[model samples]
Target: MTVPHRLSRRTFVGGALLGASALTGCSTVSRSTDVAAINKPAELPVYRRWKGAEPDLPTVNPLVPDAYLRYPRTTERAYSRKPGDGSEVKGSVAINTPIPPPPDRNRYWQELNARTNLNLGLTITPHADHTDKFQTQVAGDALGDIWTIPDRTPYLPQLLEAKAQDLTPYLSGRAILKYPFLASIPTDSWRGCVFSGRIFALPVPRGALSALALLVRADLFRERGVDPEFSTVDELMSVARSMSDDRNNRWAFASVPTSILCTMMGISNDWAEHGGKLTYFKETEEWLEVLDISRRMVREKLAHPDGITSYNGKAWFQSGAVSMMQDTYSALAGLYQQAKGDFEIGLPIVPGPDGAPAKPWYLNPNNAITGVSRAAPERIEMLLDFLNWCSAPIGTDEYTFRKYGIEGIHHTVKDGDPRMTAVGNSETGLGDFPIQYLTESPKPLYLPGFPDGTKEMYRNLKAVTPGMKPGPVHGLYSPTSSKKGELLGKFIDDTTNDVLLGRAKVSAWPETVRRWRRRGGDAMRAEYEQALEVKAG
Candidate 1:
């Protein structure tokens, strides 16, 4: 629904911690409540995998992506007809990477335009600046042909209704089969593109690849004869305590992992559905218990004192100052790339308290989506077709070219793997540009040279499928939430931190939550409930 502006590209790969209420978005000028329905597309675009090389590993859930260890030697094209109308396609995207060389100096950029048969006139904005950039454009109704947003706006449904294309007619049900690659996107992901009971965006699917997790330094844990496996939260805490050695300047965690702790204790990620009504997670008993649990951990000195302040969790994890930190599953590749030969990364399962099964929160099927501004029907078709061509799956020539570029020019092949050369990394800026956010294929459990890590990633992904839980409010829009959600979210997060570090007592959290409810939380619940009711009817 929305991308967090503060997260790095690595964080985006795994999933950004966009807080709880950052769901659907649109405009500032309020419109009538005619755009009130909350249902997703009725008949989703049916999934049909592109014919490609078979995955080396067995597929997990159909929801989980197939895994590949080696690149396909031979590839086929997905489009018989060219996507472009032999004209320029104007677009923009936000990135955490450095500004890349433009098409004139960047051969990779030039080739993409040439192959797609469209000259791309694009504007790139740093993620920090993207919120303002997008808002300015949205407010002006000047969004280019293609644009991806940074955060949920107050009136996303109204925004689209007024300025963006209504995609329901084009993408709903079997209508999308015309664009094979776009239709290949799973049904759950297609749901994210819906707002006001209509489709308004194209998904950038990540599936469960972005599930939040606790990462432990397996090499260190192994040295102490402790496997990072536990059947109970108590067992995990015991190990965390043993790993903390004040004299050695090592702690158990980089920070208090609220999401993991909440999962372990059975706290819902957003509103917990009750019959037909909804209750905000902060108002629940589980939240109170998790607050106490987190406070206890903080008091035990199991985390860095600076964890919430100036500390850099990634730097500390790399230096072994902390044995564990919370992150997304997609971080596995970067960890492998960094560990090299020094240490191994472990995904420690956060089992329930006293060994009850934990229903860990999973990310929405898509991280963020690309929306199109209003355009003539034919021009819109051209843009959609171009995105379809761009969305080619991993085993195709278009995919290979966009990701790694030509063998000698941008990358080198070694030991059955494609390696990006320095020139490729520099000119393409694949790691930095966040191009995938614009349009992407189903994610693969992939690590180019580290096939072993690829296998491990697959194993962990398959292992977590049974208990993964998605948010109830994923595709629904909440006017009060979008209007004041950020402010209220900050209030709760800051209060939680205060309690965790002894600045506020656990006894005060209920009162803090009560204040939150009055300030907008309660209003949000009513809005969501009303929307849900309208949808059901």
Candidate 2:
């Protein structure tokens, strides 16, 4: 989904007025600091070349008018083929629907086609079996004119390189600038779609430092006389111990083995270098400190008893068997609705040992990039036209509401603001649907409903956490390093799991590090270094 970018005063003022007007009595103009003034724009030292080695856009003053914000009407652009033609200009798409089997092929296709002015040929596949199915389709050249590929598939780079077309020419200059919200998308996420100086894929943009926040039961905290805002791991552990109930088999916290612990420990799966020299995350005191803290969490029993196993922390938390846990923003939404009034959910920033706020390690890449297939060159104009339409605010709103729900029906406007109606104990079937892959649509921001405290909570969390920096390994994409890459991932996972489970002592971490080096970590580093040199040259 699209993220909010650093807004110019003019833009913000205009947007505020619009929001205020929409809400009748609500004051849209909230006091906000100039983001640019408070946070320096990150400097991307590495030069990135678009298709045809195009130069970068001129740096715009955050306060000045950006010409790109101006979007043209649909009729202004030339269509590749006239409407109603039987050629490849068909408005519909064939997508692999993410749902369980016993697929309703006819009704599914009919609903999609009837809903929009398009046709749909859906291939229903379970999310669990999606990767293999997607890979098979790609290998068999069975991909439709427009289709979605899963984000977690390891073959993503290959699919982009070999199957997807360079969409840079379609999105550059006027095309890219047409979407005002596009600026909110981080540059690093855009860079993820670039390969060998060509943009081949469109990404689903996410926040730079989006991470799971620890959702604590506020009433429990108040009763225990503990401050809701615990600033250090030690403080969190103390609360966990105090709140825990082993006799009743309730946990103070249910732990899920997420990369979060490793991320906090500064263990990045993606590492980079420049000019044959390893750059960031390879050796940092902060990284080591994070790891040490994680080890303690497990050893001290503050984490769940089944933390090592793949426990469903969300289920546990919702069932009142656990009082604290970490999860993504979406997870928080689900829990908030499920636990409404019974318990007050509060968000806390991940903290460092010194009890200061620290940014959690995150990998918010732009997923679901829209692109044309090379086999269909003539469809480029049509594809661009569709994308242009999708990028507009109206289109984004429609897509988002469809995915989430419509206001006042599935949701409602509360206190002159838009918010979802509680889905608690309902049979709405809203949660059963999977609407994201309905088409190759533009991404929208995952905003919490207005007038709700959730958005405010997110804002406060963001303010406290340290902002993210571009990883040293930002734009290093080379296929040759695939084998070593797999090995490195295994090495890290094994060592980290062992340490957390107490199978391996924390003191043996240095030995594990040495083993990683011995088992191709050094070679992988060298390969990345060489790739960086080539890019610089």
Candidate 3:
């Protein structure tokens, strides 16, 4: 898993807010974007005014994203015209995947620019360094016209009020019809983008209730005549021992499998609500149990020594150094890309804890949020138009070009599905320009040309969905969390890592939690609960 970047409290939000007091409260971080306003989830916009192609599969529950067996041929344009005013637009976003050529050199970018009649300059920062660069930009007041707010970026309300445009006038509720493509964005995703009870940003929608699973090298398991499924901890340990061969530098797994274990033990994603009261994972015994499991994995040498910090765990897994690993469901396609058919990857439903039923934890629907610079309020409509063009639904000309790129040049329609050619794979992978995460439409779950992988992933998700538990505070916000979350989180993370690696005693966990609560965790919970109460009314 990629380590999330930490937003420095002293520099990112606190400092910015302090320095921004001189600006008018209406547009700055004082009144319009106050803590109370920022923490409240916006009333969801009505899901009307969108007319687009339907999905091929069943999506009875809105939380479950529609799955696709193959890409459908588009019939109509989502928008009849472009939204640009023939001007230059600059955006800053992070990309950790395959790096694309510069905007000037990338053919796909050239085509998109020509189509929109705008010079869309994107400052694609390295993912690992994005937080630092974002902070530097904020400190220096060098923000671009459009920017992505990464999941863990601190003090979003302050940042928005001080720097980002209030999009309510252009996008609040039915006002979103000006960009039907954006209106097509799932309401749950839009709810997440709210600040101070107003729609402040364009969301990058992910599956609302997605979870991570333990993926195994099934080919290796089958070759070794080992059963991939285990009903108990001991059984799993036996399988781990069989898969590991330390003399040859191989290990049973790449990391401590605590995430899956947490789900199996019925742990909530972050908080659990009961009788309108909130409880955190840190306050539960299962959290300690997860720590025990991690420590045991290290003590038993079942995990790679560098598992926690290795930048290439997937490569290690592919090389057979480790046979089992954990990754998000959305990464199913990329895992196959890394394997290149060398091994058949399999996802086993995590067994229930101590023979009890399992409950998987879902990921937040969005990976990041994009905000328009407050400095360019006049250009809000144009910016929305650009995003709407990017968000053109699954079956439209804009979607086709954005998704597949010049059908013949980058991809070709085969059996009614767009397939990337060798040139496309070499020159234009989705990693080059991560528009999907930067500014996007709802993502359909499909892996083109890999029908078997797609089907297998669908089956896994279908099986896992029924047992999933949502994060209690998915769209709900907490001012305390936005301000002190990163700092308090570090305390918990450091303690967890130290205990798991045997550098500290597991008994030290309770005290760490105590410190966290004293510092800000309890306040965050209270704020969220209050927010939830207000929303309930």
lDDT of each: 0.71, 0.45, 0.70
Candidate 1 structure quality by residue, lDDT tens digits, 1-537: 001112211011101222222322444323433326434335567788766767888876775677888866646766666688888777778876677798899988888877888888777888778867777776565667888866554456555555668877788878888888888887777766776567888888777776677888888898888767777667767888988986788998888777787778776646677776888766878888777877887788888777876667777788888988887777676666556466777776567655654655664656677888777889888888888887888778878887888789898999888887888888877443456768887877778777776776666667667756556666666656655777787788778778877898878878998899899888778876776676566
Name the weakest run of 10 consecutive residues (lDDT summed) in model 2: 1-10
Q: What's the CA error at residue 74 for candidate 2, in Å?
A: 20
Report the Cα lDDT for candidate 1.
0.71
After superposition of all CA atoms, the RMSD between model 1 and the true structure is 4.9
Predicted candidate 2 versus true structure: per-residue lDDT over 1-537, tens digit per residue: 001111110111111112222322323221122112111122222322211111122222211111111111112222233222233322112232324222243233233234333443445456556556665666566766655555333434434545567666655444554333343344555655555456655544433323445577766778777675665555666667787766677667676323344344444433434445783353455545555766666665666677555666777776767777766443554555455455666666655444455445444433344445665545655554444333333224433343334445455544433454444112122332333432222222222332133443444444443455444544454232333454565567667667667687667777777787887666656655654565555
lDDT of 2 at 68: 17
Per-model tally of clashing residue pairs: 5, 8, 2
Predicted structure 3, TM vs. truth: 0.88
In model 1, the Cα lDDT at residue 237 comes to 79
- TM for every model, in the order presented, reads 0.90, 0.69, 0.88
Q: Which candidate is the best by lDDT?
A: 1
The runs of at least 3 residues in candidate 2 whose Cα sits more than 4 Å from the true structure, single-residue gaps closed, are 1-116, 151-158, 178-184, 256-276, 279-292, 337-343, 353-356, 367-371, 375-378, 388-397, 404-452, 464-466, 478-481, 534-537
Clashes of 2: 8
Off by over 4 Å in 3: 1-28, 31-35, 48-57, 208-210, 309-311, 353-357, 375-378, 412-432, 467-470
Look at candidate 2 and tell me the lDDT of residue 140: 65
